[model samples]
Target: MRNLIHVLFFALVVSFSFSCKEEPRTPPNILFIAVDDLRPELGCYGKSYVHSPNLDQLAAESSLFENHYVTVPTCGASRYNLITGQLPKNPGDLSNQASVSNIANKPAGERPTTFMQELKQNGYYTVGIGKISHHPDGYVYGYHEPKSDKIELPGSWDEMLLKAGKWGTGHNAFFGYADGTNRNGMAKEVKPYEAGEVGDDGYPDGLTAELAIEKLKSLKQQDKPFFLGVGFFKPHLPFTAPKGYWDLYDEENIPLAPFAEIPENSSKASLQNSGELNQYKLGEEKPHLDRVASDAYARKLRHGYLAAVSYIDAQIGKLLDELEEQELAENTIVVVWGDHGWHLGDQKTWGKHTVFDNALHSVLMIKRPGESGQRISQVVSTTDIYPTIMELTNVPSQATLDGESMVSLMENPAAKHWRNTAYSYFRRGISLRTPQYRLTKYFRDQPPAMELYNHQNDPYESKNVANEKPKVVKQLMPIWKKGNTGIFKE
Candidate 1:
């Protein structure tokens, strides 16, 4: 009887100890979707005519940022700020080759090249598909050059995959047309828009989405967490989509840019001749700072852009569906972000490069594990994404970041004492976007280098009120100088 009692007691003790042992908590997975040149012109942003149902639905279920702005107005520089969590320190930091010059082939120092690299160091499986970095395929290659073995952000991604299909290379597929022709091979002879009669797979973004879904299936089998960054290339340039997306809108019903004319009392340095649009040599009409494109042509281009947005929206829907099907939605953090905004004949410009609101404002939505969807109207910067991701995953950072963690804002978007400020740098100017005003200071030898627009009175930014509002300029100058990190001097 004594032996029996001792045996049972020992067994009970072992059972209790086993039950009390803490199982290692699985880290939350991250699904980061980056869309190129996607402005705040979607249905969620109150553009009823734009067919972006997928993104709108996602916004309804996620924390939608109403005043999210990029650190820079261009693709590469903006993405650089996003990935590095740093301000522009040199001229290269403001250009398309920012990634290649600063990050590629560099040995890991005290600071990792990107937040993705930091995640990898912390035992997360990082995978990048398509244009997560400056290069279309995340490789160091020119638009016309053959694919190279050189990785763009080495050590950051465990796998950087690109399915070029009939286009031969990623860069070619980026600007590819329906017939497998690209602008690089044809010397920019292609038109600015194409409505192909084929299906979604006819374009590279469709291939990207399919590849991401397949990857998710594989990731589900892994015993660790993943940080998958899937980038969609659309609505960027040569606005091309399947005929089905183009059919979603009526050409005549598409509205033209309301503020298509240049602002009153603004310097010519503040505007460009739509040079990026004219690069499409076969484009029907050329728009200049003084010469606005005809309304008919403007509507057509806007129609093409909306179609591209709808097409990308479908790809995003596919990704979200796969996440739910894999049961990853419950444990994963999903973020849909736009690299930068585009100007569809806004201020008579057809591209993004200036420091205007059209070029700075972009889409930002974050769906965390337990958070309910809400709209955050406070101004936030692209650099804030880095620290936010790190904090969410509980990954420690080795280097100091420029932007503050938005975790507090994410938890309580209506949290008081929130910083409602965002800064955008471009065209030799640093533009500061406060809640009710936009003040831009340009570094130039010319006069009237400052431009201010009060959103409280003139939301359209129709006039430069720097001379009219001296007190406002004085109040904003100190904040504006914070973002002028000597890149202009470089």
Candidate 2:
């Protein structure tokens, strides 16, 4: 009987050892949410006026990057840099067709074009909804043309989906309105802002959220880890949202552009006309570099932007709730990133084609379960996201990337020996944002070819002190020149 008891104990110990040796650690799933033309102006970012409760909550649970900047200010180019993990190699790389013209047109080579494709190669079931790449529906077509069969970012997505709704096509749905019609078909007769009397599903973004939730439900049933990319289209153009969101704010109290005037000593060539906003010809006001919008009109526009933001916020909240309901939140790494920032009215501009801080600084938040939340102030670029994800997922990458892995910074916000710099390219110029100064060098032969703004004193960037601080420019020029990448080389 004593020998029998000893045999049972030995059997139990051997079984436990075998189980421990056989079990493998499961990698965390990635929920990547990208918002178009989103600026870092939320309650979590210290803008108490903006009604972004959902983003605020996510920021509370994640590492909120205060000084996060994009490589390019435009949508497609910026997203290209984010996916390819490379800087602008040529002039065409900085355009909106960077993805379709470069990656989609070419055959799939040995290297993956995007990090998502890398994840796919590493056994991740990748899915993309809405505007994940340059094209809204992951197709190659003009905004007014019929959707084509050519795919953008080929071999990247296992399933690329977009519910265009009544707009017919993804591009039309992108610039869509409350009604079934869109800006492309309306012949520039639409207004820039709309407060539709309908539910959340009245807009394309609503449908995007619903589809994303459905995908999440299905993804939870999959055996392998998934990388789900959900991109929201609102707050991008024709700022349209449900009336409930519009009611959340008072139009009278909305703040106007603090510095509507151009920067002193800054050349007009360094700025762009409010061309994107003025495309909506039916708007009540037209903003130009020299002409600023009236106070009432500016407030109205601000109210529209805020309403759209709140509407997207609600959609994000729905996604988060669904993630928790599916029991995926605990094992998923959630990342909410903005393609680029929009100038509501900074520097008398209303678009994101410039190299100013407002055009470059966007929203970036990352949440890893079981880790404490932090607000990282280190200057980081969108290119860094590629390596960061690779490290986070423990996926091996063979592609030559331009950005470095920021895992150390994400692990510790106040990390020592960290490079505090971000580079942005646009409008024939390459701008570098350090901890204290923003130095820009324009390739064009224009007056004030070099511009510098010290963030410590002129946070608004109301003045260019390049001539005033020649030594500072000389000190930063060598570092900023490295970002040229031969795009502006003669």
Tens-place lDDT digits, model 1, residues 307-353:
99999999999999999999999999999999998888888788999
Candidate 1 regions with alpha-carbon error over 4 angstroms: 1-23, 110-112
lDDT scores in order: 0.90, 0.91
Tell me the deviation in Å of residue 381 in model 1: 0.3
Q: Report RMSD (Å) for each prediction in the order shown.
A: 2.4, 1.9
Write down the lDDT that model 1 would get.
Answer: 0.90
lDDT of 1 at 81: 91
List, in order, the clash count of every candidate structure.
Answer: 0, 0
Weakest lDDT window of 10 consecutive positions for candidate 2: 104-113
Q: Give the Å shift of residue 109 in candidate 2.
A: 2.6
Question: Top TM-score: which candidate number?
Answer: 2
